[model samples]
Target: MEEIYAKFVSQKISKTRWRPVPSGSLQPAETFATGSWDNEENRVLLWSTGDLGNLDSDGGFEGDHQLLCGIRHHGDVMDLQFFDQERIVAASSTGCVTVFLHHPNNQTLSVSQQWTTAHFHTGPGSPSCSTAPCTGVVCNSPEIVTVGEDGRINLFRVDHKEAVRTIGLVTECHSTVWIDIPTSSTL
Candidate 1:
């Protein structure tokens, strides 16, 4: 991480605009989807750091293009993970999972695809189908595994007609994965 100061100089106002400005310093891990892990708060602080230099002095960040399509939840993001580097998933405390796909025009950026309720608490012992927040998510091949606060694991199928193809209870186990591999036999 680099420690630098940001200062603005005005042409008309000389001494008035020439005050010492502190840009502070940013930590190494505070980049991209990575957020701050404050030991004092115990809970992680998530932030979407927009590009600074890209913004004009007129206070307008929008130029000829916008990368983010939409923001689903304004609340604190519980966790984040990437899938195949083409999509970004942000799980919120409201039991909603926001999936962002790579912008079709620009493969380098992302745009929100959808925000749906994750059924982390919608099964056998669940009270009113009110879901719990997703603590973590893992993707491997055609399957996505999401672990929630209610001690349940939801399995999702990627290339299927239905998005969430299965729902089951998990006990005394960590997680599961589905892999695809082809084999060839020659004579």
Candidate 2:
């Protein structure tokens, strides 16, 4: 077993996802993206974790272990996952889910898509069902699944950010998965 540790910031970390390498790339899979939370401003960053334990305690890595790119987010990031090698999906506290694309040649990251008001919590006194926080999201190519604190789970397709299906009236749901609930039609 091997342990690798890299330090980037003091803010609370929300998620980290490694970039997937294609079959015939000359470069190995060494780049990763990270999301941070609980600070005055939230941020997402791309970093390269070079050799383990290469820093000399001066907050600097001797080699390529460093931050590559960063972007400011509207709110704290709750969760993040890679939609593909070049893209990432992030769930935010502002009730938004955003998609980002990474360009290696120019080393840039850009928001490619977003679903505003995907999930939200209107505080303790909102009668609307839309007042629930989004908890998690999962991507399976043509499908993207999301769960919310209001006990709602939504399914979306890649081409459309809007949900194709929504399961509501759920409460305090933190996470969810896609499962085959038997239908009478199948019987």
Candidate 3:
């Protein structure tokens, strides 16, 4: 039987993602990233489970839940998807999308580029009394796509700092998963 275990974290968890082990790399898929929300010190953390069974003499789950990195972010992380081993796209409640680059050697992650207010509560980059949450995000290499609660779909390119195109008035979208199947827009 598989044994189930749990770890107590300090904040509300919003998203968790597995760090992809690149092809032919002599590494195991045991490290992952966790994004937290609604805390004064909201942060994204990297964790590892490879040392679960490799405990120290004290038997306290030594080095198993070790924190690789904890970086502060602007708002509640709603979604995150890794394009590769080193890059990730994250959507937030602030209606923003960010591109992060992870440095495995130093166990650090940094925001490389950001599209601020990709979807507004009112409209594209528009001001409102409150901000709408970005519902989801997906990245296929150079192309990063995001959906938001304001009924907007934003398309971004890696080389570009802003979204190149947007589809709006989507009637309060909660999520969007990009599939390679052929299709056309209904709007």
Candidate 4:
């Protein structure tokens, strides 16, 4: 037989206070243009690409060359794809997907459109992650294909937010993408 002893100890420690972004930034392009995971001020940061831009650390929309905005998604962004070099498609772990357009001239990132009703699942029975119903998405021109852990494949068309058809399930769908290949004759 073995005996075990348990004890508890308490200690106090001091942590240093740090800040984000230097006191003053000059270069406009140095700003960020993607989603963020910081102190909740902004889920996204859009930097400038031109001359001195006016931006409020509190999110003030000022110039046309300001950082592009991100979609106000309900979940963490897992994958982001830009379509036609103008629209941004973001996939989240919560099975929610969104599309955003570039408002370059607006001087602020704005949501041109979104498709929150589209729920890509990772499992069966209501698109939950535990089931892995729909886990990933891929786009090829006019089409977007989604894969899930539920052994199912769902297809949709661009500009049209509704699912065109549901291809039978294909398990363990982590991600997908389209590759352009020439036909044998063309090759």
lDDT of 3 by residue, 89-187 (tens): 788888888878888888898988888878776544666535678878877778888888777888899789778998877564455544342132122
Report the number of the highest-TM-score candidate: 3
Candidates in order have lDDT scores of 0.44, 0.73, 0.77, 0.46
Off by over 4 Å in 3: 24-27, 123-130, 172-187
List model 1 lDDT by residue over 29-97, tens digit each: 222333112222212112233444455767655231222332323334555555544455555555555
* TM-score list, all predictions: 0.46, 0.76, 0.83, 0.51
**Stretches of candidate 1 above 4 Å error?**
1-31, 34-75, 104-115, 122-127, 160-167, 171-187
| lDDT by residue for model 2 (27-96), tens | 7678888898888878888888666557666875566457888777767787787777888878777777
Better of 2 and 3 by TM-score: 3
Where is model 2 more than 4 Å wrong at Cα? 1-3, 23-28, 51-61, 121-131, 171-187
TM-score of 4: 0.51
TM-score ranking, best first: 3, 2, 4, 1
Candidate 4, residue 179: CA error in Å? 7.7
Score candidate 4 by lDDT: 0.46
- lDDT of candidate 4 at residue 108, scale 0 to 100: 49
Which of candidates 1 and 4 reaches a greater lDDT? Answer: 4
RMSD of each: 14.3, 6.8, 5.4, 15.0
Clashing pairs in 1: none
Q: Candidate 3 clashing pairs?
A: none
